[model samples]
Target: MTPGTPGNHGPGPGDSSTMTTVESPRARVLPWLSTLARLVLGGVWIAAGVAKITDLDASVRAVRAYALLPEAVVQIVGPGLPPAEILLGALLVLGVGVRVGAVISTVLMAAFVVGIASAWIRGLSIDCGCFGSGGALAPGAEPTYGRELARDGGLLVLALFLVRWPAGRWALDAVLTRKDPT
Candidate 1:
């Protein structure tokens, strides 16, 4: 077929515009949904970190319950994670330094997966302690490290996506970087 001519099979280049039709309503809505997800998840991480900072002792206890860390390590990691999380979350939410933040978040999620897996292997029931306090493992319940891994893995993927595709619609990054004809 000619360049502008309609193909007998696939879409022709001339007929194809930059904006192609999505097959599903969901496919069309996914971008907006992704933006919202980033915002919400980022906010949640920030809030959880702040809350844990306000109550380090509780956070430490929650971390210890995972039975994955040495007590000495817990003393350091438990206290440090909140501040790190706060920084990462803020960067992600603001769309500033998002690549770095996503990397950090991915690391944290990986750590969480390790902790959960170790606890499960050792037959220890414990909370993942993902979102600050109030999370606890129920007795006789096998640890769901696999689930936590999947959940956080998905979140990490989302973070990476957000880093690549910024929340440009309504974000501080866009505001600060707006081009002005000077």
Candidate 2:
């Protein structure tokens, strides 16, 4: 068929309709990248949550070390953070509500970045307690705010990407949304 003809497909290898709607390589690749991002972010969340869930006291102490919130808020936030992380992470990993998970991850990372920056500015020596067992650092132990910030920042970027493009190969979101595999 002639290119651009009413019943003809837009173009063929030798045709010149110039109106084809072919997907770019990047579009094809993004889903895989998103899948990787989802798994990594999810795994990190699960690990961090599991680490702290076993030691609520230590989590509380870590929150207290920030010295930013009221005691009452601290009590709730410290114990609550781990489970929230776990839930968000599980959602991301399972590709269920991936966008929602990414949004939550972004917020948590932002909070972490703020907390680490605040601690560094105040010259407080304390472990982030991100993976668990965080509190005041021992004598001569230095706070690793730079490293923590860098890690969280990277995670934030990943989360942002997922937020932008939550469609991944194995995500439940894709299936649930009934996206056609064009």
Measured by lDDT, the strongest candidate is: 2
**Model 1 compared with the native: what TM-score?**
0.65
For every model shown, what is its TM-score relative to the native structure? 0.65, 0.84
Report each candidate's C-alpha RMSD, comma-separated, in the order given.
9.6, 8.6
In candidate 2, what are the lDDT values of residues 61-173, reduced to their tens digit? 99999998999999999999999989988999888888888998999899999998998899887888888866767567777889989999999999999888776666666
lDDT of each: 0.63, 0.81
Which ranges of candidate 2 are over 4 A from the true structure?
1-21, 138-140, 179-182
* Number of backbone collisions per candidate: 0, 0
Taking the tens digit of each residue's C-alpha lDDT, what string does model 1 give over 81-146?
889888777777665654556666767766776776777688766667776653465666656777
Overlapping backbone residue pairs in candidate 2 total 0
Least accurate 10 contiguous residues by lDDT in model 1: 9-18
